[model samples]
Target: MILADLQSRLRIALTNTLVEEWTLFTPTTGTSRPSARTIAFHLGWYLRQTVERTWSVDSEYDRSGMVLEQAVQFDGDTRHVPDLIVHQRGLLGPEHNLLLAHVSVDEASGPDDVPELSSAQALQRRFGYRYAMLLDLRLHVEGRRASVTPYWQWATLEKGAESPEPVAVYTPRVLAEITERARRAGD
Candidate 1:
């Protein structure tokens, strides 16, 4: 499958689930907000949906239990687990034939975390994944209504780069464009 096609599908799934579906759910607490694990589950679910929709064959996605072992400059070697991982059908191992997504939910008033990006870059460099996306969801809640804005960064081994740069802030229109482009390319 084409990498761009898969990426476009992922972008749409994330935008719809986070920006649209998440806001409608009522929070349990008056002040407390969704945690990183909560957001990770949602993102993982959407990623699974995208994989199922795009591929005809079987595939596997995990929210946990998969680790990318990397050798850091001073840390010797450490294991890093991404929020979501996608593996091709029947080939299940710690190999690099997988797609990865790392998620961070930033405070409403705070900037997107830099460490997340750095870690993602390190993973890309070590694993040489075909594609890796860093998703930072900035959340703000007013009274009972929640607002979420998503930022995306993508890394590809084709570029031969250690790190990825900020790509686009996700929106409904952007998702629509991606869908249309994929459709056109298919035709």
Candidate 2:
């Protein structure tokens, strides 16, 4: 369809995934859940930060740890949803342009990663995001309490930005705890 339609669809799907993960962790809790808006905002922040930056690099080593979340598609499996995102950048001034690109915003859009393309080198050239972050949400059980994780990060894909490799991965428990306060507000 259109970019607006696709963006909305992605947001909805991401929110659903977050909530689904949340439920899996806190299955017994009757507490209010985080809002879709909060998840989307947090995700957006990461997209603008991590993915946009490193994915554009020309590095040959693993860049997973440095980023909040990352995954590469292979074989016939192709469905992946990253938490944070940077839509698109402007050709002129930063203030004049937005992070969300017109095409990617579409629901029928294609994947950013091309198998033949190098993860770093093709990042910006193919995707064209100014920033990127992938939220890693998972369930953690400690004693009798359950928690959600949050993997928020900020990075840029601009040619001028730094190109550090990825590092350790964050779990859903970490992410939920970090944003727990604001997440409560979302309920």
By lDDT, who's the top model here? 1
lDDT for model 2 comes to: 0.35
TM per model? 0.63, 0.33
Model 1's number of clashes is 0
Cα lDDT of candidate 1 equals 0.54
Candidate that would win on TM-score: 1
Cα-based RMSD of the predictions, in order?
Answer: 7.8, 13.5
Candidate 2 residue lDDT tens string, 1-187 = 2333433444444444444444423434554334333445544443333333422212122223343124432212442333233332223333212232111111112344212113322243334444443323333445545554432222444542232532223445644544464335345
For candidate 2, the TM-score is 0.33
Q: List model 1 lDDT by residue over 1-187, tens digit each.
A: 4667877777666655554444323353445666555666666666666665433221224424454344421122433356666655445333534576666676543443334555665655554556666777666555654445567777665663334555556566864564354334333
Candidate lDDT (C-alpha), each: 0.54, 0.35
Off by over 4 Å in 2: 1-25, 29-123, 142-144, 152-154, 159-187
